[model samples]
Target: MNKTIVLACFLAVTMIYSCKKKGKESHPEVKVVFKKKQVVYQVFTRLFGNTNNNNKPWGTIEENGVGKFNDFTNTALKEIKDLGVTHIWYTGVPHHDVITDYTEYGISNDDPDVVKGRAGSPYAVKDYYNVNPDLAENPANRLEEFKALIERSHKAGLKVIIDIVPNHVARNYQGLTNPDGVNDFGANDDKSVAYRVDNNFYYNPAESFKVPVFERDYKPLGGDNHPLSDRQFDENPAKWTGNGSRLSQPNFHDWYETVKVNYGISPDGKKDFDELPEGYENEGFRKHFEFWQDKTVPNSWDKFKDIALYWLDMGVDGFRFDMAEMVPVEFWSYMNSSIKTKNSDAFLLAEVYNPSLYRDYIKKGKMDYLYDKVELYDTIKHVMQGHGKTDNIPPIQEGLKDIEHHMLHFLENHDEQRIASPEFAGSPDKGKPAMVVSATISTSPTMIYFAQEVGEDGSENAGFGKPSRTSIFDYIGVPTLQKWVNDKQFDGGKSTEEEKALRDFYKRLLNFTINSSALASNYEDIHLYNRNNTEGYNDKVLSFVRWSTDEKLIIISNFDDTNTYNFNLEIPENVIKKWQMEDGNFNTNDELYNQYSSSLNIEDSKGIINMEIKPLESFILKIK
Candidate 1:
């Protein structure tokens, strides 16, 4: 049979089985398959277990304590797993430039002028082979400590993911602990040229690098009286800034702490590297790796691939690529393909904001998932802030229908503001409805930042770290999350009643997401139907349906924060026909809140649902 006819026959069989009796002994057994929905919990490694109550602005490491790799004990990992998290993204695990002194451990001290804060920017990686000394109980055994943490996470049924900042490195990049025969970046570069395919970085040979001039209330080392805080950096033949700024003296706003890596892409948008074959997308990563074995590619690509494989060998489950779009897609195609060759199940997530480049990065770059920041995330934020309507969601889903599974959904991460912050919705309650929609609207994985469940209001004034985002650049404790930590108990002993309730809600939602078979099945939008048929159903409400052969769910959310809504939601005829439902009265139970029970009347191949939804409430109604 032709491919189209084969697909039609397969779908027809699926529909017939979908309408089978629930527990009919006479019916033949049919296996139901579902892609497990993943819930990722991101924690800044330095701050996750820090019990420091003294959060002085720009405080020294001594004043403000830091969490060590050993802090993620079995108890801690178990708590996280119980919260229904499948993956733990350990941010800032790699050795980066920090203001703290680690010279006693044979590590070089970083200049205060270039570092962002006392802890420094995690993206400005200084050593790829070594773990951060600040996170180790014993500085010399840092790598071992991290490996142990990875084992612990895996023991608790959680996978480990660390950052792979391929686009840039610390200005003073040095791999002192590199394995034998491994060379540091720029060591073999011919620095005279402005750009070279083999050179690891772009150099400006004519001028020396100057430190950016600090403005406003900011200063080098937060105005602390340090000898090296003289606004002078020693770099002969300055390199390009991480943000692609070519000026020898980059502005303070530019990514001045790090230098961009050269990936065979020229300054004028020219590609100097080999492109993937036209039919390469259909091939496996092992094939791609074999294709590059004999080819002479850029030296930087080889180095990154080796780094990724090293982590994979050490039990690291995956990597979250930083600013992946900034680097060339062809290089990612080469690098990520090599990573998958080593471990095919390795989760490769990229941060790519440009919508136009989404498919190119996923298909050509071999990325498993990319942040849905510019579209779904931005739209959800706008609706939460009372600026946009719920009608914007269905179109976005339809537009990315082919690639929705590849687009990872998240309400907050390291780069975004907290939901409880003044700049966002100003309260954690506003996130309930948004999180419901973000988690259930697609088959994509959902990520929640550390302390997001208990409402960590990122309102601290830590040096070099502004409010609205937990300071990744400073040694600071998250207030709300600290309560749950309760000084390393990993229990909510000190959390307020409301905070505990919020965390419980998150637990329920995330656990349901992972266990729900319908989440990974077919989706049908019911927003337009309810808007047209149900009176008093405003833009604040959104509804959809997800169904598989064995499971069906009607998800509805009320985005409004003030008034409760009572309306009759109409289920479209197409959805009823797709599910092969017969005309009758069906009983439905809310899976989210089991106390609520309702009846759906199916007539004329359509259904009407009577719902009395509270403000910011959501329902996952299971049809019976």
Candidate 2:
């Protein structure tokens, strides 16, 4: 009897242990610090104050410097910060030139920003080490203004992210050289080349063409057959010219926006070399070898890692990598790891404009976040155009699930068209509600482009034209901009009465998102909500639910010009607390219970709980 009893006890203990092990394996909670998972507002410095629509020539960096990012502090940006944005991304902080030459034809209205000194494209960075003196704090103060801006941002409790162009550099800045004429740039021909501080390089998948002779101060390089070396390294290596692609062509120097890289000739393809040729390998092979060539940009990996660390050390939470697709996945993976180590809560958002490009970034864990351009584009453009409907909502919600941890959602970014006006073919007041609905309710982190809050509007051409428009924000201002920022009102337009109501509505939604675990939920389930059978429930009504084991948030946005929709929600009973509309209106007690789980009419124009939408509008309802 004693032996049997002992054996039974041992088996029971083992069973319990097995169950516990399985439980642990079945589900693991995420360990992430969401400092501010609410909403983030973006500011494009050039367009903050003045209404410069045409990128017309500004006097000089000296004259325009005051209007640049330096102006962002007091008005638009400050307003946005006050609106409760947890993060701010300032575009074009580093110097960028709009490389068009209007001199021969005379400056036209379409020219963006004129070449004050030597206007080159912003993407074609002249150098990373130096700050655009004009854009800095004092004319000669250097990185001071940039640093001060960062300090101010921190004091406001907002995390700031600046653009980093790791893939390319400027074509016209002249070679980095000493006053005595020593080509002391990163492209020196001697053993001390690695130590040189003048030149920069990018990762070359198929190395081609040798490093060209450095040309100083825009002086002509006598060498022929070299590509501009400013544009993207060719995807097709067979296109390489023996000497260099662009330089080899006559008059190629006239076009200074892009350039090809340097690489040695191979029977198969062009091979990149940092030091002198292989047979003449008298120099230190390891140090001199250019890592960016097929293998990796020699020290680029370390350099970027250090850059990430430097920014974080200075109290930045993360970086929004530009042109991420061009760089090697290994570079981002290393960067992501290093930044997370320094600040585990760091938000690494990659600007991989296309959703198809998100695979590698997601798989390698190289990026913790990416822009969800697909859903946003469809919601703002197609849906607003009256093409797709509510059924179209499923795919977007599903896509967010797959990339939830690394997703940043938005209706309009600096790259795309504004959400209001011609883009939506609706009034600024009408289009705004839909934008807010889409942004706040989406599973991904929301990003509000600079002029978004105030019902800003413009055309696609406004983004990249001539020297006329100083900044992107100069188009139009709607009250939504200030209201969302100051929390004084949620009004989508210029009306004061509407602003106060809208403000409360917005606050309720924002607070709900921040407090609940739904915003952080990554569940990809699609069948969880059903609105197909209801009348007027179509693509016009965008709806999705984000839920974890403990919490859930149901987001519904109407993109119709003026349509009433009834949609049914399948949710657990006793979850909803109160219904909060965009105008600070609410329904509770008996009214809520009577409408529970039923299709509620949304009458946006009538100021009633009817599901009637008045053009572009968004809604947020709180669950008890």
Candidate 3:
């Protein structure tokens, strides 16, 4: 070969290598750095209350008038922002069915307190584009209020995420229902009426009909069912007959009660009926059905794209999808694709309760946030509540890895029980410490549920057709059980020194969790360092770690019942640096301690490192 040609080839090779090296230098390791932002605060439709001793089913942001939101905006949100929260999720904004007949769900309309305030669970939406009247500034100026709220949130530097329920429509929503039995737009209410074969309703294999098996007991303490205290729900549903009784349904299903959507096709190459005849053949019905077949409802795909774009245009940051499993993967694909077309920063967090189903969406990049139920339940709730042992740590660490790659982490959400409830019932002395610790120290995107700030120990499962006073707050807005939350010292309330210390610990923990560098970057490499505990106090200590090529954070949560702990841990030989203490102390070791001790000492019985977590608390020792 000629020297000239060889020299030219060498130059080309050198340029390619240089570009590759530059790329590696700019972006080293697959680390997803979490921006130093506050854990997202999620507000539910059913939880908001007023000073006038009213806990109506639903109300508008504007109607609650400045007073209600003032607490949320000025106090709650301010605290959240101060603690470094990055986003907020406001669920149930759309219109829902106002069920006048409470007997349908075992609720009695008799209680004068059962005021159906203009709106219901926003999930039962009559219109997606319009905000519920109760949440509006005035009936006519609702959208403006939403815009203003978004503006306020943005000003506070919080990304706002609205909930989108696509799986089903409200059972009794107006405009969609044709009173004359003939659907004006061919949108039927029949369960079997499906537009496509894939849209068929889920049927239990054991049962002959298309229904799910639900437990009768609403609250069972230990099992899947929660006990039902409501008197109206005593009758068995299996014994009851429907309009056209083909057979008695022994098992429970997500039927019209929680209407299941038709994704278009069935196993038998048929469409599940909404309310009309299966495969209805009519020019009007076919045309309307075709329109409904498209994912963007109330309008065409182009229009739906515009709706999503409109929110983005308003500086809205993100969205949290409800029952995302029911939505066609194509809809999410289109949403993610279309969203990227406009802005890259827009985040999408889907509420897919099942992890396996969630992964499908995550792989498609359909969402950036998801409910980390596995870790939240297994590690935080179970461990801190004295329900889990040290053995549970390994699974939790593994679960965190799966969740970290594709989710914004959160603790209890609207669908589940409240964190402060007896289920996670740590004593005001014990639980609060663990609660604050777990909320802050995790690597995935963290979230705070409504009423969590004030430490409201409400039930996680409220809407199980029960009339119980165990909600986030009582009817008369005295903030029943408010002591569980109020950071007494900060709020100028009279709390003991220990209580005050616990409250301050939470603030500090929040600061450290969000600002940590190692946690922000390669969290997967972080392993569960030490989950060892007192032999008899296996139920107490919940310890773990998050480390990468550069740093490590050891999290220890003790949920013991006044049991002092003294344990040993095996640390990685390379891990030497330690910084910050939960008790307002910071530590540094310029001279590295080059040793791999099989057992590290654990003197403090309960307290999160860096945040000074107290009994029933969690902490992180930042090692970098």
> Best candidate, lDDT-wise?
1
Ordered from best to worst TM-score, the candidate numbers read 1, 3, 2
lDDT per residue (tens digit) for residues 1-624 in model 3? 333223212211111111112223321222224444347777753334333323332322222221222234545555557755677887665545432232433322221111112223456545455554444435456567777777777777778888666565543323422223323111332323222333222332333332223456422111322123122222111211111122334234323223344444343544332322332211111122333343432222233345567667867787777777656554555565566546656767787667667655654434656676665555655655666655554565565564453555555566665555655553444555455444544455667675554455553222322222233211222243233224321252534465455445545655656666555543321224443322323445555555544555565566765655554433433333332222222342211122211223323322222222235544455443
lDDT of 3: 0.45
- Candidate 3 accuracy as TM-score: 0.64
Q: For model 2, state the Cα shift of residue 425 in Å.
A: 3.8
Model 2 lDDT tens row, 90-184: 66555444322222322221112112122334454444443443344453454567777778777767788766666544433332212243231
Candidate 2 Cα outliers beyond 4 Å, as residue runs: 1-36, 49-78, 97-120, 173-186, 189-256, 259-297, 354-356, 421-426, 459-512, 522-529, 547-553, 566-615
After superposition on all C-alphas, the RMSD of every candidate to the true structure, in Å, is 6.0, 12.7, 12.2
Error of 2 at 524 (Å): 7.6
Top model number, TM-score: 1
**TM-score to native of every candidate shown:** 0.94, 0.64, 0.64
> What are the per-residue Cα lDDT tens digits for candidate 1 across 1-624?
233222212212122221223234233334333366889999999998999979898998899889888889999999999998999999999999998888889998899999999999999999999989999999999999998999899999999999999999999999989999999999999889899889999999889999987777677767788867877889989999999999999998999999999988888878887888896664445556767777788899999999999999999999999999998888888898788766777889999999999998987787889999999999999999998999999999999987888899999999999999999999999999999999999888899999999999899988779899999999998889899999899899999998999999999999999988889878889898778778989899999999888888999999999989998888988999999999999999988769788998999998988899998999999999
